[model samples]
Target chain A: MSSRNRIESVAHQTVQKSGLKNLSFRTLGAEVGVKSSSVHYHFPEKSDLGGALIQRYRQSLATTLAEIDDASPNAYDAIKLFSKLFTQECSEGKICFAGMLAAEVEFLNESNREGLQAIFNMYHTWLLDQLNQAGDELKIDLPTPTVAHLLLASLEGALLIDRAHPTNDRLSSVNILIDSWFGKIN
Target chain B: MSSRNRIESVAHQTVQKSGLKNLSFRTLGAEVGVKSSSVHYHFPEKSDLGGALIQRYRQSLATTLAEIDDASPNAYDAIKLFSKLFTQECSEGKICFAGMLAAEVEFLNESNREGLQAIFNMYHTWLLDQLNQAGDELKIDLPTPTVAHLLLASLEGALLIDRAHPTNDRLSSVNILIDSWFGKIN
Candidate 1:
């Protein structure tokens, strides 16, 4: 792989395993079989590298959501599909990187914060679109904006709980709540 | 201050600003004007210090919740009180340490994970008691376990969203949703 690719891959793993704090030149250098100086040659600062990682994560998530554009979907199915995707990601031990970074927004640089917002924006836009489509098809009253934030926030939070507790039982318990909240409307 | 208190103060700041990955004896000692060896004199291993910090955070949160008991004789008041306390902390740019550690549970030592769970257990216990009391007064039916988990998860997740987007407006938006859901329930 090119040095840039190698650096991004390494930083991604480090963030995945240890979060943003451990994304340093020394760590990336070790991971990529390069010296810290060489790592710096490709990316002048850690923030720049972080910006790239954030962008890559956003793109990857966007791509994942893009793949599931089913035709003729109703509001309930749309919500269920989103929940299924979220729960599957949690089960795989990964979650929305933007969601994770959001927990530490006070500490993030301006650029990183904007990048994180872009991820949420993408999610909200897609979600609103689905909700509109579903609401029209199902002829149901729904709280679009509130439901949008609720779905994202609750899924992110549930992932934290499930990971901390690490029980399928707990996850299923949460799914019941999600299903009830969305199911009644759909 | 005692060496234990000194180490804790430093770890608290580190956890607040940079999070657990940046938590180390050397970094924490530097924050407190001590050598890493001197810090180790107080904490034989990193886990010893981390475990203590987690305990301190739990105690502090419990103390905060204890104060709410005075204002929360009924369920409606209790829920409102809890929401106020939670939002105030988030708006002040504080991420709950247990919540943060829970995200990193997959990477944490067994001791750290235990500490995280203990925090959650304390939180859930307090919430259950408050909800049960409120339910009786308000005549609202709530599934104690499910309600406990839902409230905790939604609040934590909303903090992540508000922190991520971080407009003053986002806080109000989340508060509205909280009121709409939890407020109406009981």
Candidate 2:
């Protein structure tokens, strides 16, 4: 991988584990086996690093949502596929990059803050479209926007709950949310 | 209020607004009209203030749960009562103190970490008990603990999504989750 890509990868994991605020150029250097000056050379400003993290994650999520659209027959499967994204991260003891930024929104730089907002907007819009497409056929009572927001919000919350509280079944919250939507999957 | 209690109150709001990691004695002093050392004198360490916040919040939640028990004839109403605790905070653009700490858990001192765990434990146990009592009576299909975790985690996440995304209908997620449980409240 290129040095720039490697630095971004490490930053993603660190932000997921700790948060964006604690991420430093020197630490990125040590983690990626480059000099701090080299890390700086690629991204001079910390906000630049933060913006890069959000922008990349937003693109990746968009790609995955499109892939799910191609694969899922209906909203139920679409949601289940989407949820795998979060459940996968929670199992690894990390929140997703968007969620990490959401949790740390107050500490964000202006550019990073705008990037975070754009990511959520993109996510909300895509999920709403997926749910709206399935709305008429399904017997779901809630509006598409409401369901979209609830799923997005709760899944994000599930990350914090799993890490802080941790159930005997860590995915209890995730499973129950799916069950709420379309009956039990397992 | 006692000078020490005043400091805790201001610190609590500050932590809710930003995060526990950003809650400094200096800031608390400025907010409360005291010297930084005076803030320290009241709570010698930052962790002490955090522990105090959790301990106080735990007691208040316990009291609120008792009040909910007395006022709520069933789990549906009890859940609503519990949700109000979060909604009230979200309207202020602040996540709850426990949630703020949970997000910043990696930066916390050991004492504060345990305090957070106990608070979540107490909340989970109370929520579970409330749901279990109304289980057979209500038409809800999910298990007691599952429902409890779903409500708690989603409500916590609603705070983040609301703050980060700022939906046109901020409470849509909260309303829809309740609607899923017991149909539309209004």
Candidate 3:
């Protein structure tokens, strides 16, 4: 990785492990084998680093969501793949960057705020479309917007709950939701 | 207020504003008009403060849930009161301390973990009971535990989303879930 990417990669891990509040440019510099000033040279302020981190995260999510949508044959398959993305993150014993930012939204600045909200807005629009398609394809009365919000919020909430008690995963939130809507995906 | 109570109160606000990672004895002391040592004297470690904060949170939740149950004639009313508690917190521009901790679960020690998990467990048990009663009272088919988790997770997730963009509240999460279940709570 290049020098700046190295700083961000380590910084991202730090945020996932703890939080954005615990992220320090100095610690990130040492982890990437550079002076704190050198790290600052890449990103002038802590907020700048935060902004770049979310910007990169948003780009990656946009790319992944597009790929998931393209690879799936139908909305059910598309939804399953989408739900897997979140549970996969939880299984890794970490919170997604979006979840992390949402948890600490108050401490975020305008750039960070817009970056993070845009991510949720990204999920909202994507899921809304997926559900609207499901409503037609499945021949069921699915409240597209409301159910879309439920899927998005429940999946996001499950990540936080999973991180707190990963071993206590008896029933998967996404499965419960999908089963209710589609009467089991299998 | 007693000195210890004062410390805990301010510490609660600090955690709600940011994450547990940002809570500092020095900052709490300055906010509470005491020396850092005084805050330390009250809670020796950061985890100790975290544990206490959750303990207080759990107690208040228990008390509130009981009150809501007693005041409401049926599960529908109880559910509305329950959802309002969370939305009210969001309207005040704050993330619940539980959301904050969940966001930074990787940084929590065993004591904090147990404290936080116990809070969720309490919700799980309480909501399960309410859903079962609702099933009987309303004569509706409901998967009690799964639906309960949906309610709990969606409400909790709504708080995080609400905090991220408080002014952008277009729809109320609780109402959406409730309307689907009980066909509007009003």
lDDT for each residue of candidate 1 in A134-158, tens digit (9 for 90 to 100) = 6444332336666667566666777
lDDT of 2 by residue, B1-186 (tens): 988889888888888888878777887898889999998886788887888888898898788879888999877788787787657755565776787788878788878888898988888899889777875555566677777777777777778767776663535567566756775433
Regions of candidate 1 where Cα sits further than 4 Å from its true position? A1-14, A24-44, A103-108, A136-143, A168-174, A184-186, B1-3, B24-27, B30-37, B136-142, B168-174, B182-186
Error of 2 at A164 (Å): 0.7
Compare candidates 2 and 3 on lDDT and give the better one: 2
What's the CA RMSD for each of the models? 3.8, 2.4, 2.6
Model 2: number of backbone collisions: 0
**What 10-residue stretch in candidate 3 chain B is worst by lDDT?**
B165-174
Error of 2 at A180 (Å): 4.7
Residues A60-153 of candidate 3 have per-residue lDDT tens digits of 8889999999999888889889888756754466666777777777778888998888888888899888877775555334367767777777
Model 3 alpha-carbon miss at residue A97, Å: 0.9
Candidates sorted by DockQ, best first? 2, 3, 1
If you assessed candidate 2 against the hidden native complex, which CAPRI class would it receive? Answer: medium
Judged by DockQ cut-offs, the docking class of candidate 1 is acceptable
Deviation (Å) of B15 in candidate 1: 1.1
Flag regions of model 2 displaced more than 4 Å: A135-139, A168-170, A184-186, B135-137, B168-170, B184-186
